[model samples]
Target: SNLETETEKLIQIVLIGQPELDQLLKKNELRQLRQRITISWELLPLNRDETRGYIQHRINVALGKGRVQFSRSAVELIYKYSHGIPRMINVLADRSLLIAYTMNTKKITPKIVRPAVKDVGGLNPLTTWIDSLWKTILPGFLALSILLFGANYLMLPDFNKKNVEEKDLNLIIKENPIIPKNLIISNSQAPIIDLPQSGNLALEKMKPVTPSHQAYTPDDSLTTKLLNPRRIPSTKPLIIS
Candidate 1:
C-alpha cells in the first residue's frame, strides 16, 4: 500500500485469501491496512447461467467443441452439487467423463453425473433435503408402525389351541401312487455258480476270483511244498565229516 501510494497508485498489489480473510482484515491491528485497500472484492460463486457456461467452456477447451456433450439435466445437477464452485465443478465433470467413457457412451446424463457427484463428496440441495428427511422421519415412522402392529395383534381374539384334523393316509397314498416302470434286465454269458438274489450279490458273483490258469491247477504239489517247508541237504562235499 505504501509503495502504491509512493508511486501515485501506479503499482497494484492484490491480496487473496479465503472467505474468512475479510474478518481477519477487520481486526484492530490491521485497520490501517484495511483502510488502504481501495478495491475490495469478494469472489462470489458463479450463478446457474455462469456455471453452465464455465463448464461448457472447459469442455470445449479440453476436448474440442463438439467432441463431447453434457445433457441439460447433467449440467443442472453438477451446478447444484458444486454450488457453482469451479474447482468442484471441474472435479465432478472429470469424474462424469470417466464414468461415461467406462460405460461406452459419448453423452453424459444425470444418471452418470449422480454417482460422480457422490464420489466427489457433494450432494445437491434436493438430495440433501431428502437425505435429512429420511434421517429425521424414518425412525419415528418405524416406531409408529411397530406400535400399530402390536396394538392390532393385542386386540385380536384368542386363537383356538385345538389340534388340526389329521389327513387320510390311504387317500394321500392313493393320490400320489408310485407306479413302477418296466426295468431292463441284462443276462451274463459266464456260467453261473449260484443264482444271485440281490444287485450286490450279482455284482460280487460276476467278479473273477482267480485267473483261468491259476484256477485250473492239475495237482496240489506246490501247495504241499509250501505247507511242509522241509530243509534239503547241501550239494558241497568238503564238510561232509
Candidate 2:
C-alpha cells in the first residue's frame, strides 16, 4: 500500500530544472508544495568567448540559419554593450540584423551597430543645450532693450530744455508793449533835457504872457479918465489900470 502511494505521488510530480522555469514554479507554490521540490541549480552567465559565440549564433539564426558576417570591431562593441548576458546579446543581434537588411548588406559592422544603438539612446552636447537656453532667453532680452531705450528718451534733459526755451520765447513776446511807429523818437543818441532848479521858478518862467496885457497904453485915455471911467461912462470905456 505505501509503494502504491509513492508511485501515485511520483506520477503527479512535474519536473522543473531551468533557472527561469524554477523561479516561476516557486512563485506559484503553496508552503506545503514548495517543500516538495529539493533539487535546483543556479545558472551562471556566459564568459567572454561564450558571449561572442552566442552573438554570432543569434545573428546566424536571424539570417535564415545561414552565416551572417561581422567585423572584429563590431563583435567587440557587442561584447562591450551586452556584457555577457545572453538575453541582451539576442536583443542587440536582432537589431543589428534589421539594420543590415535596411542597409542592403549581409555584414554588420561597428558603424551599423553604433547608429542602431544611438537611435535608441543618444545625448546632445553641452553646446547644444547652451544654444537652446540662449534661444529661450533672447526675446526677453530684446524686450528689455526696447524698454530701456524708451525710458532713456523720455528722461533726456535736452528735450526738456528745448521745450522750456520755446515756452519762454512765447511768454516774452506776449508781455512787451506795442509802440506805434510815429511815437518812436529817432535819435542817434537820446538828448538829455535839463530843467531849472526850483519847481515854482521853473513854472513861472515857462508861463506865457497874453498879447492884450503886454500892449498896455497910459496916454490914450489918460489917468484921470481911467480913475473916473465907471462914474462918467454912459457909454463903455476901455481903460488900463
Candidate 3:
C-alpha cells in the first residue's frame, strides 16, 4: 500500500508537467494545495551568438579569468553542433575542456570536439554498417550460389559428348565375310575330308583284324586256293566209303 501511494504521487507529478494540469487539478481534492504554487519558468534554447558566449563563459570560469583560450574555428563548430541549445553548449564545452587538458593545449579545435561528440554519442557511419553486414552475409551467400550453380549444371542435359568415339567390330566383320575351305569345294568333286557331308563309308565302319585270326599265305595262288578249296578230295572220300 505504501509503494502504491508513492507510485501515485510520482504519476501526479508527471501529469502536472503537462499543459492540462490546471484542468486536471480542478477534479482532485488536493486542488487547494496544488494551487499554492507561485513561480514557474519555461527554459528555452539560446541563439547562435548566445551559444558561443555560453561556451566562452564556461571555459573562462573553469580555467580562471582570462586564463584559457579557444580558436574562432572551434567556437564556430560548437555553435553549429549545439544548435544554440544551452544544455548542448554546456556538454560540448565540458568535453572540449577535458580534451584540451588531456592534450596539454589551451585551444579547443573542431577536430577534438568532433571525436569527443562521436565517442559520447556512439555515432556510426552508414557505410560502416553496410560493410559489416556484407562481411557477415557474403560468404554464406556465395557458397549457396556455388551450390545452386552446381545443381543447375547437373540438371542440364549432357551435350558434351562430341569427344566420345565408338568402335564396331561386328560391322567390320559383316563388311568382310569369311569363307571356309569346305564351302569352296564343288559337289562333283569328292567332299572335303574334314566336313560332315563327305559320305565316305570307308572312314565310317573301318575296323582292324587281329594278327591271330588273319589268314597269311606266301604266294597269291596259295591264298586263292585256301580261300576256295576244290571238291576233289570229297570225291575220293566217297569212293572209299
Highest TM-score scorer: 1
lDDT of 1 by residue, 28-55 (tens): 9999889888888876777789988998
Shift in Å, residue 34, candidate 3: 5.7
Clashing pairs in 2: none
lDDT winner: 1
- RMSD values for the candidates in order, in angstroms, are 25.0, 26.0, 27.7
Once fitted onto the true fold, the runs of candidate 2 whose alpha carbons sit more than 4 angstroms away are 1-33, 59-67, 119-241
Tens digits of per-residue lDDT, candidate 2, 97-159, equal 789899999788998887766664542222335677788888889999999999998887665
lDDT of 3 by residue, 1-241 (tens): 1134633532222232433555565667866656654454445656667766777787666665566776677777766666555766677777887888999987778878886676558433223457777988898899999999999999987667553334466786668879654454343333222233323353355354558878644465644555553433221211111
The 0-to-1 C-alpha lDDT of every candidate, in the order given, reads 0.75, 0.63, 0.62
For model 3, the run of ten residues with the poorest summed lDDT: 232-241
Off by over 4 Å in 1: 4-11, 102-104, 122-241
Q: Each model's TM-score?
A: 0.44, 0.37, 0.36
lDDT of candidate 1 vs native? 0.75
Q: How do the candidates rank by lDDT, highest first? A: 1, 2, 3
The best-first sequence of candidates by TM-score reads: 1, 2, 3
Q: Which of the two, 1 or 3, has more TM-score? A: 1
